[model samples]
Target: MIIVSASDDNFVPGLLNLLYSTLFHNKDAEFYIIDAGLSNANIDLIVNFSNRNKIQSHILLADKSQLDRLPENPYWTSAMYARLLIPQLLPQHSRAIYIDADATVVSDLSELWTMPLDGNLLAGVLDGSVHQEELDHVGMGNDEYINSGVLVFDLALWREEKTAEQVVQYLLRNRELIFPDQSAINATVKGRVKFLDRRWNFFSWKYPEIPAITPTIIHYTGDNKPWKKRRAPLAAIYEAYRKLSGSDFPRPRDLPEFTKARRTVVGLFSLRPKYWKIVYYTARCRSKFTTPHIRQVMARASQLDQAHPRKP
Candidate 1:
């Protein structure tokens, strides 16, 4: 069975709505939900909406009690570890696909579900950022890294692998190396993982140089998301979810206040700064540097702009 996981707080409604649309599109899948910190009231609302829509599926509620009992890790949040519960919730199956809530399915996901584990512990696409030299520089093997945004796991192997325990131990022993649960998973399952096609977990940031995109599944990876200020060719994907859900999805629960304050500070700085242009260009340059695909797209766009300058 195919499975998708999400941990929600204030954005529970939007996530559920997106998942609901996903389910409607593919009727033969089961959804596993973890309301990491939401109240019973929110859970009820989700349940009632699913039921009303006649979306047949099981809901594995990671209640507050369960959330409170998880072992602590300096780099991992309860929400991230809550994903490990999928094996226990699966129905006599040794494999399942994990999709983040920030994602929306554009096509049927049976292909992702049928991906061969090949005795490897897990299967996922490699992050576009980490080159072979970079991996060596970081003292890691090339096979040891995979983006955690999308994962297909052998549940039985995961359980036997003691991944949870290993992650906790790594946190205790090497806290500095641990960024989050994904880091631990990549480290533990490294070299033993099967690599899936980039198309399955296609990050919008990875292929900006391409003139067109035909993605089966699109991931909103990195800090610059379609939901945020950066240019996203796949903004239509986000719009699809918004239109289906009748609400803007994946809205950051904690972003508005922080953004307002940040904007206010920036506005004040804009009035006083002799180096404001430097700051603006620096920010743009940083984005282009971090996500090279954007730079490629910008260069192409610049050429196009010069060839056909904006008509008055």
Candidate 2:
């Protein structure tokens, strides 16, 4: 299968871990790494890893001029917009799977690869944090929004429909979108998107009352990155992949000690007005709505890590 992902030097470590975890499950998968301003040293490391593993890998340099034209925010870089060039970049491929660098595959991807698109241009999981305001901002309904982190692109259809051009134009016109690429794609594609099961692109922060199945892919969304904060939710799973990938990246050490009252205050202040209602509900139901399922999922991940036994 053709698997595509984009990254720059800052995210190379996460990219390495993602590659290692994916290869562990899908050994024969081909990789297309979009080089969004990766340094020579970082490129060498990726090339060396691919060579040592004897995997089919290609690193394509992103078009800097095109990337510069896209809107960017403090949280997301121009690299996020590079996925828009996928259909153009890989004209030879009929279909491809695009996964974000901030995610790890825990199950075999062949299931996802072989799934029929049923005429949809793209397939992805719904964004857990999607708000009505975000959808309205992009002129889309709440149900139409999907996370761009994990996607199944029908490249043939994308090329035929000029989806790349449409999305780019939408983004250029709607610079105020909170999620530039995601919102643009949602608005542009509209009815052509296929919603997948939540387990496909499960956010690490979401703790369901009763998880029916283990997540096939774990995505570290938002600001609590495992590399920058040691105590981030589900960080051990990410750490396992990092160790398995043989990455010597330094561990995060400066974990701040926040008092309970201070943490509560900070969390309340950090939330947007739209989310205050949910927080209020959560506060009232904390005793009845505890997240023991998260601990169970973490334990399962820990067991899997132990079974794989990474070499030091």
Candidate 3:
């Protein structure tokens, strides 16, 4: 009954809403958050927020020195890499479900916790943004390229495979790609991942066709986040749980493009310009360079396999 998620300052509010929705539906679940450089004030807010909602939560700080070796982007910080370190960090936990902060759980996770992985390293939904080309680039079948947003993992098995270390090595060799940890997971494990239902990581683009009954998990994929003013029911859903969480955190301000540009200009003085370059390089190159390193990581993976890979 363990649910895990990784977050930093940028997505702190989204993490709060996620916790609210998840704990509201599954009262008897253990929750953990990878503390990826969240402020003490924000951590205090999370503590008070969870306490007010009666949801028990554990915050695990990121080992920045370990995570710093991986590639990152402005779209995602080094905290995103923390998910890869779970098997090593939480060795005591046999299994856990990893959900993105941008996603919401509308169904009881206890049922999900009961679903067996059946000897797979992880189980996740396929990505909405993925295409045949992207799948080919990663040397995976179109259906095998999963969305890393929501995953059920067998941590002990992951540890035996040394997945976190292998992924870091793969990233070091590849150095230039988006979805760093995600791509690493796919490349290292290759075709071994089991596919979970898309409803578990339901994308907003499918909002029109979603059944009247609530989805298991609603993913706020792409740029149109629910934090600010948005037109869809997703926004309403997010707002509801946000209120349910009893969070009095300030509503973020929306800025026009001109104002955003001005703020960006001011921010540049205090920011390191190198991250923009790194993000640009990845976007421009895409996954055109993952082949060789991926092959190497695959070769390096443990050949000893587990028979009955059960979840906790």
Top candidate on TM-score is 2
Each candidate: RMSD to true structure? Answer: 10.6, 5.6, 15.4
Report the lDDT of model 3 for residue 41. 89
For 5-48, candidate 1 gives per-residue lDDT tens digits of 76656446435645754664577877767666667777776766
Candidate with maximal lDDT: 2
The lowest-lDDT stretch of 10 consecutive residues in candidate 3 is 301-310
Candidate lDDT (C-alpha), each: 0.61, 0.80, 0.73
Which stretch of 10 consecutive residues in model 2 shows the poorest summed lDDT? 284-293
Off by over 4 Å in 1: 10-14, 63-77, 130-138, 141-144, 207-213, 224-233, 247-312
**Candidate 2 deviant stretches above 4 angstroms:** 208-210, 260-312
- lDDT per residue (tens digit) for residues 239-301 in model 2: 776765667576789646678546666666888554575465444333232244334445655
- lDDT for 265 (candidate 3): 64
> What's the TM-score of every candidate structure?
0.67, 0.82, 0.77
